[model samples]
Target chain A: MAAESHPGYGMRSHRSTLLRRLLRYVLLVATALVVAFPIYITVVNALLTPQQIAARPPTLFPLHPHWGAFASAFSTGHLGIFLRNSLIVTVTITLAELVTSALAGYAFAFVRFPFRRTVFFLCIATLMIPMEVTLVPNRETIVALGWFNSFPALIVPFLASGFGTFLFRQAFLGMPGDLRDAAALDGYGHWRFMTRVVLPMNRPVIGAFAVFAFLSAWNQYLWPLVVTETNGVRTVQIGLRQLQALSIDQTNIIFAGTVLAALPIFVILVVFQKQLVRGLTAGALKG
Target chain B: MSDTRRRRRLGEAALGYVFVLPALAVFGVFVFYPLVKTFVLGFYRTPPFPNLPSHFVGLSQYGSVLTSPAFLDSLWRTVLFVLFTVPLGIALGVALALLAHQRLAGIRIFRTIFSSTVATSVAVASVIFYTLLNPEVGLLSYWLGGRGGAGILQSPTLALPAVSVVTIWQNLGFVFILMSAALQSIPDDLMDAARVDGSSMWYRFWHVTLPLLSPTVFFAVVVGTIGSFQAFGQIDLLTQGGPNNHTDVLIYSLYQQAFVFNNTGVAAVMSVLLFAILLLLTAVQFRFFERRVFYGR
Candidate 1:
């Protein structure tokens, strides 16, 4: 009698536990839906024509989806030029940042030099200095060099990234001394060893920082807006804002342009979400 | 003593310095040079290019800025923004971090959703939000107000706070990610130990978590405060410094006085004042670090 009753109770308890998990799954799925709603709305609205968007209750489908916005964005304006300008600025900054950061990180991590720790600390200290405090002076220096309104004006000032130096330094510091010793035993020398061995191992991290550096440089508005005024060097962001200012009357086009401006960033985020998350938490936690 | 070995040692040392000097040179030209230029430019005024000769105005520009009502008003507004953003950001950060730290189902998905906005540029965010909050065509108002109601951005009283909401949302992901990592560094053993002692979760968090998390909290506060002061792009894009210059901070004002109004000296003066404020605040923060930071010791 005891065995039969116990077996029946155990099965009943397991069934309720299964039911609880099912309920939790439903709730989790619901939460995810709400969280994803904004991106859904943004993309849907971007694809839809103005008339379709204006319709009540906002049906999920557009009456007539327009691929023509992209064409208009390109042909009717300097969006092409803006894209070229963005590419040039982003590429140059990334190259400079990578080269400088690797060397500096290598030095701080591996090399024996006078006041090496102090120099590294100072480099890290630069991270704490507010960007605003430096903006005026940075601008003055750029103008004084006659680089204002030029591409160099946008690029040169930010070549020394405190955050990058810090990242590289810490990553390099974690390297085993025996690797360098082994390299030295082979007479590879310091620079060659760093170039061959250290840099290759650092590719994962460098790729991560590359995305960050590119995004940060590309998204720059305050400094770029201040420096570049002419159509010759205008970036996509600056151009979009200028276009929006023109579209106060035509609200649809303004939203359309905003959607266009936000597209590349949104796409990058979606694809590289994992890498960016890893990079951010890694930098924050490690540093 | 082998001369070749000694030479090789020297060469290696030389190589290290050689590799590093170019980066140092760039830093010197770009950052250090401008740092010095700030002091010089503080005392002079010049017209924009195709012209030369900054008239040395000495202390007059500085004097005028120090006494200006507008400068004082901006300083107050900046303080208000800092006061609003820092604590609120820290609170939101802590809440979101702790919420994700729970053993709830699908927590990773929740984290990714909250953090998605961090990848969006401030420029993109500002643009997206401006459209969303516009007086006429904005969806928020269309939903909230049946028809013909004032949009948040179009209202002078509402614009700054509305813009602040966008900033807060944008910055939330960054702060959450940072603080969550900080929280993770605190081993679960500590919480379990407190639970064994009959402490509630709130009690454990208040006693254990916060003290341990103070360093990151302090860091976030400083970064948030500094960013608040320097904020220009959102205000410039959305409000154009205001429905009536209601949202102008120091950087926006500096941008206007220098470039828009062509009062380069006055702008330089305002910039210097901004620098001084930041330097003083940083100094104070550094001084507090030794006393306040728990470091789990």
Candidate 2:
């Protein structure tokens, strides 16, 4: 009697568990769809005509797709130039940030110096003093240097990042001390050890910071807007704005510009999703 | 110590300084010096006229500007934006994290979808929403029951909230990623123990999951508050702080004063005041929330 009851109970619970799992998936799929709705609409509308877009109750999908918006965005919208500029600025800034951050972070983590703690604290303190606070004076400095509407103004102020320094420092400090000792015993100097051993071991952190720096540098709007007066050096973000203003009636063209501006980052996100997540959450989780 | 040993130690210290110099130089020019100059600029009033010299006004402008109705209104609008974005972003993030945290098949795809907005820059996000909020052609406007004629972004009463929605949506992926990470760090045994004790899922979530997640929540709130305080791109792209200055938060106000109106001294003062308010808010959050955060052993 006990054995027979046990089998019946197991089957009932199994059916209920299956039902619960199905319900969970249903809810998850629904939420994911809602969250991703905007991107889907943007992509679909980028392929639609202005007439279709303006249709009452708006076209939900591109039944008949048009690719002219993209071609026009590149040809007339100057999106190609903007994209090249964005790529140049972002890559340069990311590389510079990595070099500066790795060096400073290594010094703080592994080297001993006078007022080391105080200096490290000061570096971290700069994180609190955001760009918004320093905007006016920085702009003056840019103008004073005759770097207005130039790459130097966009690139120079951001070459050093306190956040990057802190991230690298934390990652370096977490490394095993024996690696350093081993490298030293093998007649490795600071530069050699860092190049061959330390940096290679911390690729994950480096990759993480690289993605962050690239994203931020690419996405910059205010500083670029303030500094760059011409389209010669303007980034894609600003270009998208210009496109919108110039073609107020052309919704499809604006969407195409947006798609172009956002595509690179989305690709980056897809490729380096792990590093982005790990790096972003590193601060929060550890704190 | 031997002389060689002393020399080596000194050499190491010098190298340390060398490694740090480039970073410090950049910071000095861009960050530290500008900070001091901003404070100094606060004391001198630049006239709206381009050719006119800036007059030294001491603390008079600070007094007047701080008490001005324009400044007060902008501050209030900023606070309203913070209230609108941070908590709701956090709640939605938690909800998404909870849904995605389940041990279901193909969960990774769902996680990616949920966190994809993190890739969208403020500009991209604004542009996406710009098209979505268009009065005549916008599907969202139609579905959302936006009143006939003007879109949500154009409506004086609805503009700020509309902007806030974009801000929240843009930040959703970040909060989702953070919360999902926090949820993953939680031990499976804790949930199993509660289940064995016949505690319902809600009870376990309330008693166990929430306490463990408080630290991340606190971090998100502080960071979200700071981000909201400095919001600019969306306003510039969408409203330009118009339709009666309803969406003119403090940062936008500072931008107008410094760049548009050429009230450099007033803008400088606004920057200083913003920094103080942010510092105070951070300190207050730490004092109030830090003790309540549970660090599970």
Candidate 3:
């Protein structure tokens, strides 16, 4: 019916369809393997011992797994402290952004206020201004505040995001008006309604923003490098750079450090796969 | 009653500002204020530290930075990097998206594998490539050892291309996801209609699907170009502006001047230039390409 339905076309035989599907499957798997092979080898190298790594014509797979690679990476590579620093900065920023964006989003969406359009336009304008343009001045600001080398220095600048606010605002705008009226009838003011209904109901947006915020904060290189003068407050990204500079000879150990640095984000990505896709494609569908 | 209603309205307006204050305060201090300071900083030559006095220099800094051979070279390299990455990145993204869009069993697994690079941070991705491209003990170097028996990244000529390879690989996932989303969004009925009109598969794809995909392609190009322009982590890790400064793109050059060389004024000028380029690129994209972008009715 599918082929015959189209005029001037004959229906495709089932066998051809099956064959086409089989070819697609092969192509897809082959491409996936090719894309994934670098990561596979990286993991394999991370699991190999120093001697095995140095062996000529490098071993493709680790015959005997070296679990000690991770232990060394954490203890010696200083990745443990780096990981802790990354978690602290990421969590602090994510929580603060979630609250601020959600609050601002609710204000923009539900509350009729003076100068709302102007304020919203200003907030959205920040999205077009790349963060790299602000690096020099922000570093100066951090120094003036004496927050340099402190957690606040790493966390405060990114506590609120224009993108997060926009994402949440779009989410809030999609809510039915009747629901807001009904909530108002139930004596739920803006604050109460936001906390009780909007926040809970927009879990997907919250989750998406949370994953995005955390990932951005975690992956931040330039800001953390600029602000943090000491290794004590440095994040995993900066620490990875330090490791690369310091331990070029210890290639296997560096791979171990890489694994440790990337593992949590990988786990988060796997767990929050849908939210990541939604967060990423959210911009694509819009502007 | 009217007075009470007016009071309520005023109360709501006050609450709205109150709600927006936290985000506003952060943006005001960090984003907006910094933007203004960047412009001001461009006009003054400041010492490395904050306490030192800064002298006004007008647009001289911009003129010097624009004419500097180092800046000019890096700008040329950056344009090359954009050329190397954007079109190829778009083409590969579209190809992968088209390939994965087919209906088949276990297709979701393939999608996951293709998109997995999104999980990799720039730092992690660079580290992976650093290990993979190490001449002394890298898999790729051992496999594809060319003249001089050095890694591709170690060679002066091949460094940019090697770094470009890492970027292209890292960016493929993002581009693929965006393209696949655009593809999936195209209604099946339109394609069906084309088929009913006796359009061959190639004809349908070229005329119908390709037109529908221009907006996504355009978006990818704009974002990809901006991203490549600002890309620092890969350049920092992979080449450190290189064996010969061949990989010394704009952002890294700015960073070196600002932080390493303590030339904040030069860096500020470069920042302004970068911003202008991005603005111009975005404008050009919309002005030239917007007409071709098919907005489905």
DockQ of each: 0.30, 0.48, 0.51
Which scores better on DockQ, 1 or 3? Answer: 3
lDDT of 2 by residue, B72-121 (tens): 99999999999999999999999998888766779889999999998889
Over B1-297, each residue of candidate 3 has an lDDT whose tens digit, in order, gives 699999999999999999899999999999999888898899998666778998898988788888989999999999999998889988988988888776566767887888878878889889888887777777777767644545678778889988888999988888888888778777777777898888788898799988888877888888898899888999999999987898999999989988998888888888889889888888998898888787655
Question: Which regions in candidate 1 have their CA more than 4 angstroms from the true location?
Answer: A1-39, A54-64, A113-122, A128-131, A134-148, A246-252, B1-6, B45-54, B103-105, B146-149, B196-198
Predicted candidate 1 versus true structure: per-residue lDDT over A1-287, tens digit per residue: 01111001123488797895577567656654644444455556666665555555654655567666566656655677887887788889988888888888888777776667777776776665545545667776778779889999888777767788888878876778689889989998676888899999877678778778877887888888888889789887887776666453444455566667666666766787655655555544443
The CA lDDT at A192 in model 3 is 91
Which number leads on TM-score? 2
Instruction: Give candidate 2's TM-score.
Output: 0.96
Q: What is the C-alpha RMSD of each candidate to the true structure, in Å?
A: 6.0, 4.3, 3.3
TM-score of every prediction relative to native: 0.86, 0.96, 0.94
Model 2 reproduced share of reference interface contacts = 0.73
Best by lDDT: 2
Worst 10 residues of 3 chain A by lDDT: A1-10
Considering only chain B, report the TM-score of model 2.
Answer: 0.97
Q: Evaluate all candidate structures by whole-model CA lDDT and list the values in order.
A: 0.72, 0.89, 0.85
Candidate 2 chain A, poorest ten consecutive residues by summed lDDT: A1-10
Q: Residue B254, candidate 3: how far off, in angstroms?
A: 0.7
